[model samples]
Target: MGKITISQKGSRTIYRVNRRIVCYRDGHKYCVGKPSSGSTNIEFDALSENIAHERCIEICERRIYADMKYQNPVAYNAHKVLNALA
Candidate 1:
């Protein structure tokens, strides 16, 4: 199981998704460390307001579910929904 962490960078607070020992940042929401099939940097910027925090939560939750996709069908389907939302 991987852990998601929240840390402060100067005055800005950033989120990190640690999956398989790889640390992924908020602005860079792609996981290049695991599942090496496809990894693309996801942009999480909002002009209206700071949507980074929300995106980080969504992404991390989706990933956590995705990691356990095989064992639990419910969580897998829920992961699909979250993936769609994200």
Candidate 2:
């Protein structure tokens, strides 16, 4: 999995993969990389924030679900959720 970073410049936010330029804008969420020359930058601050936050929540949920699965394998099927979280 690639690491994600968020940066803010003036009113714009940039999302990068490793350190190479990806996308820039005035929001928290953006496409993971740079657009082709002459292309417009895409901003998804709300979606980005939602995805980031949802991943965090899914992490916690996975832990709990894992414990339950271990305690009673037949009663839980959290692998799907955990995979989605990842």
Candidate 3:
């Protein structure tokens, strides 16, 4: 897999997976929350739903202005959670 880019869209941040965008709203939306200020990598594919939920919670708790550099942690974490659910 490749890296997913998280971008700001108004008050919420979006994750770019392949060509699809995932958010935290709606029933189908697996991951939701404000992304780290800079960038972060999440090991989504290897994470569990519980882990994903924890990661999302962590992201939600993060300061909006804090700088994040890796994307694997969030991406892979989400991927794992979503994959298990799917």
List the candidates' TM-scores in order: 0.31, 0.32, 0.26
* Best-fitting candidate, scored by TM-score: 2
Kindly list the per-residue Cα lDDT of model 2 for residues 1-86, writing each as its tens digit: 57777765554555656423444332223343222344443554444444544444455566777778889786575565666799
**lDDT for residue 82 in candidate 1, whole number 0-100:** 86
Question: Per-model C-alpha lDDT, please?
Answer: 0.48, 0.51, 0.47
Q: Which ten-residue region of model 2 has the weakest summed lDDT?
A: 26-35
Error of 2 at 77 (Å): 5.7
Q: Write the per-residue lDDT of candidate 3 for residues 2-62, one digit (tens) a residue.
A: 5687765444445756533455422224453323323333534323323445554456545
Instruction: Name the lDDT value of residue 44 in candidate 1.
Output: 22
For candidate 2, the TM-score is 0.32
lDDT of 1 at 73: 84
Off by over 4 Å in 1: 1-50, 71-86
Off by over 4 Å in 2: 1-43, 77-86
Better of 1 and 2 by lDDT: 2
lDDT of 1 by residue, 3-85 (tens): 76665644345444552222244443532233331443332212111344345556777666666886798878876798799
RMSD of each: 12.0, 10.5, 16.8
